[model samples]
Target: MGILVFDDMKMLDVSGPAEVFSEAGRFGAEYRLTIVSVSGEPVRTSIGLRVPADAAAESAPPFDTVLVPGGDLLPGTPIDPDLTAAARRLAERAGRIASICTGAFILAAAGLLEEKRATTHWQHTTLLARSYPSLRVEPDAIYVKDGTTYTSAGVTAGIDLALALVEEDHGPDLTRDVARSLVVYMQRAGGQSQFSASLQGPAPRTPVLRLIQDMVQADPAADHSLDRLAERVRVSPRHLTRMFRSELDTTPMKYVELIRFDMAKALLDAGHSATEAATLSGFPSYESLRRTFARHLGVSPTRYRHRFTTTRPAVDATRPALPDVPGNR
Candidate 1:
């Protein structure tokens, strides 16, 4: 595989996938990894680290796959003509193509993804779709495969995409080992929004907003209708709605649902069954919990538990138990 590198590109966008392939190679896969920059010169990465190129992109041999990883600056900035040209040139010679995060911008600018279904970081999916009107962008996807072209969400989702690629190349057995070696799940249960700020935003600024949020969280199963929330905070329903929109950027009932959703996820992560999780987290029924999971997470509650929770019984019974994570062990 050939990785196309450029200045200011995110370091992990290159390294994350590279490590997956590298680990697979260590386990007897036949991947020959190479990194090529536009001019074979060392380029600065997002964190001020310099990455040395193996060859110039224009002169590099065609590989089985070419990867275009994202950069923080690529989302809103102009696509560099030289970099885009190099990517276009490299992609033309490769058998298959993929992009990680906002690297889709470069691919789109190269006219490769004109009509392809693609995605980028959750924060920039709207901009990507609007800027490139021809591209069919799936904003909620962790990664999308439209024919041979693959695009993934921001940052760590690149690893997920890489694992998928490895699975396609080899099979589940080898790919699962690679994922285990890296200490990441082979696939995440949901879309990127579960890791985004829409549901997990900053603390409320005002006293009333804070107080109202506290009450909703304190009893997610309770009737947190606009009228009830307003009564608790001694405000009119309309005023409360406006306050929530201004501060939390969501409605009162939506906030209540999000709180319940969070609790349900926690319960599932702690080895509870979906049915038990729903009951403990205040959902009226397992069906309600499943609907909320499908809406926000793009996966069923049972699927989410198996993928994310180490304590839960995994569907892939061949695998041993893994640790739950805030960080690597």
Candidate 2:
């Protein structure tokens, strides 16, 4: 794995994945890690930490996988042309290419993400879509894999993406071990929206709207229909719908659905059965919950639980034990 680093890059964007791959090596996985930059010098991170580079981009050996990490690439901020060119060259020669967060911008600039489904930090998704219209920018995905190229959202999503790559290259057993070592969920229960739901919608403007939002969140099972909500707020149903559209930019029913979905997901993540979660989250029935999950998440509750659950199978006594690592014992 070759990770390209540069000035102002997010430190976790590089170190998080590096630690996962490094841990996999301890578990008997074969991974060769190298950090490179346009120049061979150490690069300062966005948080002011300096990390030494292994080699200059031009001098680096060929890699099976190349990752470009995100940086402070805000709007009107200039990207280094030399770095972009080097990334393009490395991507062309690598078996697979991936980007973390705003690194997708570099890949897009390199022409590597053209006509591909990709993602970046939610705050920057619009810019990426606007800048590279040919690229299908998925704002809410944790990560997207299109053929040999992969792109992920935000900084910590890099770890999730790296874990997924490890799972593909190794297997679930080893991947689970790595996740256990990291103390992170084997996989996140949902997409980036789970972490950024507040940012997803416009803030409630009026006190009535705010109160209704809090009520729905506190009790998703309550009557949250337009008529019921209007009654609670002492407004006409038409006026309530207009308020939701103007302030939330969504219908009242849509807001209720989002709240119910979040509540259901929380219950499922807590190890609740689908039927139990559905009934508790006001889905009417398990079938209703399943349909809602499939329509919005494109995955069944069972599948989501299987992927995201931290539970793992008992270790096989016959298999060789993992070697002890310093500080772990």
Candidate 3:
């Protein structure tokens, strides 16, 4: 396998799988690894560490696999066309082409993701889809296997995807060995979004609280004052507050904010403009939207859109709307 590292490339993108393949030595000498870059010179990783490439891309031997990683690049970003073209040429002979995080951007720009079901860092899914309309981007997937291409979600998910590759190429026993040695989880069953959402405070329970969740998701833009919501559900606002704390573990207003944030994320993922997403999500202004986004998600709406939104496509028409409880990720 050949890992083609690039400028400002996420170090783990190269090292994660390299270590996985290297660790295969513990089980048996099963795979070969070569790290290459655009030029023969050493390059710096995102963390300011220097990594030396075994050879230049032009001189590297053909390999069965190619791996790429993501980094912070501005939208409509211009890249060295020649370097990208070289990577694309190398990919032609690769049995599998994979990317971790925004590294999918490089693959997509090379037209490798065309008409493929792929995913990237949640924040970049929309922009990747928008930039490459033919690519089918699944926001809720931890990793996507589209024919010969395997794309994974943000940061640590790369390790999971790499382990999956090890299992596919060798065996489950070898993968387990690598996992045990690494001292990390064997696998993350769901998408990265679930892990990210788990960082949100606890969810709500109880019939009234559940009803509130349903109503908020149904139409977050609805004029959902706590008093009106309580009255319609046959309870006083004070009782609603008590129930919310008792069951959901948060106040009614805080729960509303969470619901609104979820809706805004949905809208943003669906390709709505930030201004439109803010208004539809019940935030009084874009500033409010940005503040809540930073407070809850650690990213701005624009940045989130840059990472996740390209074109707003309708959700699955057959799935029922969110019920009276928060939907599982």
Candidate 4:
């Protein structure tokens, strides 16, 4: 498979999945992992690092499958037309195509995602849908495989998608072994938002914002109000609102809602009852939790768990065993 890393890329978007593929090769699977870029030279990463490419786009060998990685940059503008055209061409000939994170933006821009179901980082779902009206965006999944195209949400979720690919290409047994060797769980339940906590609420700047962050993290289930939070942090409500907008690029209420949903999903995945999870995560009631779940994930909480927590048939069931290649293992 060929993994393409574009300029201003997120490093983990490719590396995490590449690690899974490398380990799969170690377990006797045949893989040809190549990194391609528009120019043959190394592309700088978002985290201030560089990764060298195996070949330039013009001279790169054909690939059986293609993977595109995304970054923190905006997806709809300043993209290389040449790169988009190349991706379109790659999708035509490749057996399968996939994207990690906002790389779905590249595919959608390439016209590859039209009429196909895909997922990107949940934060960008509305933007992606608005930008590409033809593409159907599903936000509830960690990774989505629709026909020959695949897309995943967020950054590290790419690793989970890659393991699923290995499971499809080889079998569950080998997939399990690779996961065991990697020391990371092969599958994550629900979506990327589940694992994320408020950590630092809406990007702290002032000491007051820092205090508010601490309060949110300490008691996520509390009935936090703007006035109460402002009093706790010794700031006026108007001043607090301005600071939140300037630092977090979001409102205080919205940030609290994100934190509540994030923590609630985690608790639900940990086997907590929906009512308990709702209460613990600061939602007013279970009905409120259900409404938010439907709005953000497009699924009822029960349906989301049922779809993700349940297992599916192995992909290798209809396939023959792979032929042994000399020196492959």
Q: Estimate each model's TM-score.
A: 0.82, 0.85, 0.62, 0.65
**Candidates 3 and 4: which is better by lDDT?**
4
All candidates' lDDT scores?
Answer: 0.81, 0.80, 0.73, 0.76
TM-score-sorted candidate list, best first? 2, 1, 4, 3
| Cα error, candidate 3, residue 88 (Å) | 0.6
Query: Which residue runs does candidate 4 get wrong by more than 4 Å?
Result: 189-329
Ranking by lDDT: 1, 2, 4, 3
* Candidate 2 off by > 4 Å: 74-76, 189-199, 309-329
lDDT per residue as tens, model 2, 208-293 = 88988898888888778889999998999999889888888888887887778878888887889888899888888888889888
**Every model: Cα RMSD to truth:** 7.1, 7.3, 14.4, 7.5
- State how far residue 206 of model 2 sits from its true place (Å): 1.6
What tens digits encode model 1's per-residue C-alpha lDDT throughout 124-169?
9999999999999988777877666889898888888888777667
Superposed by TM-score, candidate 4 places the C-alpha of residue 176 at a distance from the truth, in angstroms, of 1.7
Model 2 TM: 0.85
The best candidate in terms of TM-score: 2
lDDT, residue 20, model 2: 90
Q: Residue 192 lDDT in model 4? A: 36
